[model samples]
Target: MTLEALERRRLGALIWREKRAEAPGKEPLLRAIAAFLRRHGLDMLEFPPALEALRARLQFVRRHEPDGGWPDWSESGILAGIEGILDGFLPERFSKNILKQIDFQAALKAQLTYDRRRRLDELAPEQLTLANGRSFRIDYSAENPVMAAKLQWFFGVRSHPALLHGQVPLTVQLLSPAGRPVQITTDLPGFWGGSYKLVRHELRGRYPKHDWPENP
Candidate 1:
């Protein structure tokens, strides 16, 4: 749904809650949460998936571990947030499933990934030249407002953290002094691990429309 529609729905839900009306549905709460996150730079077009994730997450929160102390409830604000949606929607049957599925180890692994994703800051240069001889770079950091705009246009980008998570490729060469990538490296993100070269191969092999380099 459109951002504006989401905003309206979320606000409507909030007003209803303040007035002691029935709590809002999941969609509205998700939208409210998504909208609020956007204010802080979440950059997503929609957060429908976060609803399921949050549901699974909340169950984990209430669990009692072996230690006498239960888990800290620090993130209750975030949970409480976008939570009005769960007013009546947090299903009962889903409890067993959510508790079972929330493997802390698995969740920990996922959190690590999310942490790496969060660490991804925009490139300092946004564009660079490897050798400057038959080479150019789009660092995705510097004066790449145009590049950022293009991302928003083609990939629905809105936040400074677009290039992370391998979600969308920051298209360069076409927009930069270099119209083709001499060498593309995804190593820095580490999430891409060693797949940068393979990604290059795929670029050349798959979407020829973008004119990926075959030689390098």
Candidate 2:
């Protein structure tokens, strides 16, 4: 009763093509595609080498892991991304048939490029300008984006720098004159109003030449 691997793959492809022709809409087609893959097993379904490469690249970019160390692509992630693109960006009249006819690699490349640009605009930034007119580059790859700067660089700033459209605060890595991290905090005001004096006391004797203003 079991089908051969080749037979299963052919069946999967045939079912996919038939589902597209039959259902045509995004949601319905996605459901059909998911069912087809699940029933036949994705390993048996041979995708074009170029198509697979594009899919992997798209997944990698979307996950923000450009270092080529991304984990293996999961079925759910691929399915979700496909549904997202079909529903969000594509025209309402767009359907699975277009996927068959179009230059998918080119289309996917354009989509990935646009998405990367949009995310860079929205979530990540190279530098944050403090109230003191000092700009520092932020490391967005970290779980919490970090900005390592000299304590003096933040002297005039009373509040923590906000990022991610002013919703999330940056983790400030306050460095000493010798470029050592003296304090790490996300709450600038709390550190300035409380622990800063204690730290100033400890560091003043070691770095007597550096300015440590009482009010800053």
Query: lDDT for each of the candidates?
Result: 0.33, 0.63
Superposition error at 155 for model 1 (Å):
15
- Model 1 regions more than 4 Å off: 1-193, 213-216
Instruction: List model 2 lDDT by residue over 1-216, tens digit each.
Output: 121112122564364332223335556655554555466654544557755644543443446555633323455654445444334433344443433443434434445456564564455556788898999977654557788999988998987997756777888999999999999999999999999999899789889999999989
Give me the displacement of residue 103 in model 2, in angstroms: 18
Worst 10 residues of 2 by lDDT: 1-10
Name the regions of candidate 2 deviating beyond 4 angstroms. Answer: 1-119
Error of 2 at 137 (Å): 0.7
Error of 1 at 153 (Å): 11
- C-alpha-based local distance difference test score of model 2: 0.63
What tens-digit string does per-residue lDDT give for candidate 1 at 1-216? 122221232464364332233445556545654465446542232234433343333223234222423222224433433334233333333221332322333332333244333332222222322322222233322222113211111222122232323344443322112234433322223323344456556555655555434222
TM-score of 2: 0.51
